[model samples]
Target: MFTGIIEAMGTLTELRRQGEDVVLTVEAPGLDFSDVKLGDSIATNGVCLTVIALGDKRYSADVSLETLARTGFAQAKVGDRMNLEKALTPSSRLGGHLVSGHVDGMGQVMSRRSSGRAIEYWIKAPADLSRYIAEKGSIAVDGISLTVNAVKGDAFLLTIVPHTAEETTIARWKPGHRVNLEVDQIARYLERLLQGGAGAQAPSSTLTLAKLAQSGFL
Candidate 1:
């Protein structure tokens, strides 16, 4: 698990096809890549990847065919920047919203503009994923936790502070660029609860509010 706060920006060092899979290499920034071990999970642009090898200041992970197809990761060229985040420990403070580091779908950057002292961006998301987005709701974009400033059909907008733009890859985004997105964990839980009738009496059980009050269980 992770809090979608980006720790650093990593540059793509190499990407090579190895039979049916692709190996992705990234140059870590300001972070100690020495401690990164094999099988350690790291978020690369909101996509959870297991470290397969560690270099001087770079690390490598193998990307499956599914990842390449679903994430538009195959389009990542050398030197492209990616938002990087280490997995959270039990003692780590969750400065951002809960993130599974699992990219649900790809969203394209529609526009990036200056909004006073902040930077505002618009992204076009998949039609199905649009329902999960709400104004002021938490959303993880490329591993950076942000609040939705507004929603417009299949697209949404968010504001980025200067610090965020400098520390992460938001500043590098432009029209047609793709980003990973993850919805709020609480909303997913709510959906499951409502769908499964969590904590609610089954139909035909006659467990109405008045009945519960009379039963001293209200």
Candidate 2:
């Protein structure tokens, strides 16, 4: 697990394809590598990647085909900056919400505007994932934890402060740019519980205004 708090910014130094999988070399001199070891997990742009090889200030990991199909890494290139975070330890402070580093779906930047010292961005989430997003909810975009300022049909708003832009890759996002999105883990679990857990069949009808009224929930 991860706290979704970005510890350092890394650059994709090399990308080598090996059969169906690809190997990535990331260089993050700013990252503290003193305690990192082989087999450790690192959250790279919201995707949990196992460290296959370690070096002075770099590490390499193999990206499976499943990951490439689901993350922005499909379009990633050398020199691209990535948000990096080490897995949280038991003693680590919960600075951000619990992040599984599992990208649920990809989102696209819909619009961008300046909001005083902060930048306001609207990103369109995948249609199927919209139900998991709520106003004031927590979300991880490209591995950076952020609060949802507001929510529309299939899009959500975020207010990125200067520090966040400087610390991570949010500043580089533009309209139509794709980003890895991981919704709140709690929300996902709650949904499974609501569905009766595990392999239980889904409800025949979704909760709606009329159903809420009938159930005395309105």
By lDDT, the best candidate is 2
Candidate 1 local lDDT, 5-69, one digit each (tens): 88888899899999989999999867666557889999999989999888787889999988887
Candidate 2 residue runs with Cα over 4 Å from true position: 198-218
Worst 10 residues of 1 by lDDT: 202-211
Q: Cα RMSD (Å) between model 2 and the true structure?
A: 3.7
lDDT string for model 2 (1-218, tens) is 99889999999999999998899999999999999999999999999999999988999999999999999888999999999999999999999899999999999999999999999999999999999998999999999999999999999999999999999999999999999999998877766755655476665646455665698733
Weakest 10 consecutive residues of candidate 2 by summed lDDT: 203-212
lDDT of each: 0.86, 0.93
Off by over 4 Å in 1: 197-218
Please report how far candidate 2 places residue 181 from its true position, in Å: 0.3
Model 2 residue 168 distance off true place after TM-score fit, in angstroms: 0.4
**RMSD value for candidate 1:** 4.9
